[model samples]
Target: MPPISPNELSDEQRPFDEHVRQVMGGLRTPFTSTDESGALIGPFPVMLRFPGLARPLLEWFTTVTSGSVLSPRVREVAILTTGSRYGAAYELYSHSRIAAKIGLPDGVVAGLTAGQRPAGLTPEESVAHDVAAHLYTGAPLPGALYRSAVACFGECGTAELVFLIAQYAAISMVLNAYDVPLPPDAE
Candidate 1:
């Protein structure tokens, strides 16, 4: 159960804040609405309590997750690594599904879930995984690891990777803080 419940507002009672509207709109792509009430599930309902933070965070999350220079395969690898390092179950579960959906190799997802570096990654995927592992372990990236990330991703892509790590970490914090439970039917 989430520590906070979603605001049970109807359309007529929606808050009149433009930022809230923008955040709500941004959520559609990544989340499915509930069947009867059409409410967004996941961190959103918890976030909506503070519309100011919700707007910018959700917008940036959408951009990085959807339009980054990193391939979806590469992005999901870094995300699931963070999820695994933190034992952030929601992140792991959701992104594992996404990883498979986008055709990430099964060995990669399985290795990540077990907190080991999987075999058979492309060179670029390996660099991304290394970076996430270093960050999540509370250690600085070795000079070689940093250089490898820059080489694989370029400077801008590398910067985006850092942002992606931080964003997912924030999400994990929210989910853990709220003790957000997975839906009963989640696999």
Candidate 2:
């Protein structure tokens, strides 16, 4: 079973029963890809079903993390680091472009993909990368890394880090569960 399943709960169409819709925002795309139909899971139908319910949340998440909180550079680092942690091919492939665009060092990106310690990392980026890896590995992040994140982000930034991590991790889980493949044109 998924850690959280949108399928199990029927939308009462009630405002409170709209966690999925809230997460999805006002997205109207079909639950699955148009090319083919298969088992459905994760944040699809909820989006396709109620854009009014889903749109706001989708916008909230996108705007908050990617647009406002983390700089494009930091955002790309966090995402690519998380993708590397999980060995999620789609995430890695997708973020590589974003990371490059944001000027993330190529060495750091490659090191993350190989699961090796990278050289020439700033303290903040290093902490975030390590913490993300620790999360995926089920190992407790060391006190030093946590302290480093606190030092780098301060209180609010640290909170945003957790939020960003959880969001991406949720996304990865959904993709993996559904075996969501990259689009044919993905590059």
Candidate 3:
């Protein structure tokens, strides 16, 4: 059972004021747009219970997913790696589609789902995969791995990689502990 029932308050039932609009507005993705009539779904409705916390979480998530130093593909790779490691079912379900929408390779997603490093990753993807794997597996980053990641991603990008790992790890914990499920009709 879900740890918390999703907030079912309609937009009209809730404030739906300018602040809510702005916060929700910032959460759009290429595949998910809140401007559309029915696009506010997934963890969002669940988060409505705590607007104060949700505001910054949504804002930061938007910035990380959209404006981070990491490429969208790399970001999704790290997310998928963490989601798979934790067996966060909702994370996998949601991010798999996002990964495909962002043009991560089919084989790569498949590999991540199966907890294996998929073949045919670009050099950048490989670095992300390796970094995520090291963190998820609780292994130290070997000197060569660290140097290569720094070389590929630069210092800031490398730092963001670690941050993304930690962030997604927390996200997975929330989804798993709360038993967040795939949205209705999602396969």
Per-model lDDT:
0.74, 0.60, 0.72
| Model 3 lDDT tens row, 1-187 | 3222225455642553345446645644333323234434545554555666666665666566555788889888888988899998777877888898889888899899777889878898889988998988788888898999999899989988988888788778867766766655456
The runs of at least 3 residues in candidate 3 whose Cα sits more than 4 Å from the true structure, single-residue gaps closed, are 1-40, 52-56
Clash counts per candidate, in order, are 0, 6, 0
TM-score of each model, paired residue for residue: 0.82, 0.65, 0.77
Q: Which residue pairs in candidate 3 collide?
A: none
Candidate 1 residue-wise lDDT, 1-187, digit = tens: 3223236654432552334446556644333323235454566556655556666777788677666799888998899988888877767777887788888888889898778889988899889998988998778889999999999999989988989988888888887887766654457
RMSD of each predicted structure: 3.7, 7.0, 4.3
Q: Report lDDT (Cα) of residue 47, candidate 1.
A: 67
Worst 10 residues of 2 by lDDT: 30-39
Best by lDDT: 1
Candidate 1 Cα RMSD after full superposition onto the native fold (Å): 3.7
